[model samples]
Target: MNHGAFRPIELRAPEGSVVDVRDDAPAGAHGEVRKRAVSVALGALSQIIPDLVSGDLCGTSFPNAIGE
Candidate 1:
């Protein structure tokens, strides 16, 4: 991740969640994790500003943005 770009950003996720990684976890999944995080953030924001924020737009399977 570009730590410099998000220098002042602070995130507090629960332990063992997708966003929270343990030392034994495999590496090189940052991009995937980031995408899921974005989806989650947008979903949260939609609750506060439904009209302004887009919903169910993520492409990953984690959130199942588009159901079968």
Candidate 2:
């Protein structure tokens, strides 16, 4: 009756390597990861900050990043 267990994958990349893109490609790739991370963090914060301040956790989640 194990319902919460899961497996993990092992991925390793060497230094100075493009883990996400092809090697030695001229690409504006750094912003995508950061932007996604920030967007997700802000979304989560929006869903939690109201309850954290007002002590009520019944509010629906809202999209904090309007331009996404």
Candidate 3:
């Protein structure tokens, strides 16, 4: 990937939102936030290029419990 090829991103999320946290927000759970971010970006891109983008990804990494 060419880092210099793309311009810097300027995101403007509402204060105290999931992506924008306060100084004393809860710790951990960054993975979940990252997954949702990717899904959102893909969804936006899908609108312009529907054929290139696939379905939304599963926004989770938790393992399901199996019954005996």
Candidate 4:
């Protein structure tokens, strides 16, 4: 089965931006940072693919596990 023609794809993170945070701010707080980033990304993706992502996003059972 032919998949189809190739299409160009590009992904970039700006310098010093939150999407690509600098090293000096906080290394230990990466867990919080990661959650925020995922929310932003998944929020965007859900708009286009809501069904696939519907049940994928949920609250953590162990809320305090990540210092949240």
> Who wins the lDDT comparison?
3
Candidate 2 lDDT at 43 equals 66
lDDT of 3 by residue, 2-67 (tens): 766545557788978888888898636767787888799879978998877667777787645455
Query: Against the true structure, what is each candidate's TM-score?
Result: 0.45, 0.33, 0.59, 0.48
**lDDT of each residue in 1-68, candidate 1, tens digit only:** 56554335378988766677777775455667787788888788779878776556556645333434
Number of clashing pairs per prediction, in order = 0, 0, 0, 0
RMSD of model 3 against the true structure: 5.6
Q: For model 4, how does the per-residue alpha-carbon lDDT over 23-53 read when each residue is reduced to its tens digit?
A: 7754665566666666766788789978655
> Which has the greatest TM-score?
3
Model 2 Cα lDDT, one tens digit per residue, 1-68: 37645243355656565445565764454555445544655566568774432222333343344442
Q: What ranges in model 1 sit over 4 Å off?
A: 1-9, 14-17, 51-68
- The per-model lDDT (C-alpha) reads 0.68, 0.49, 0.76, 0.60
Backbone clashes in model 4, listed as residue pairs: none
How far out, in Å, is residue 28 in model 3?
1.5
Which lDDT value does model 2 have at 14? 67
Angstrom error at residue 5, model 1? 13
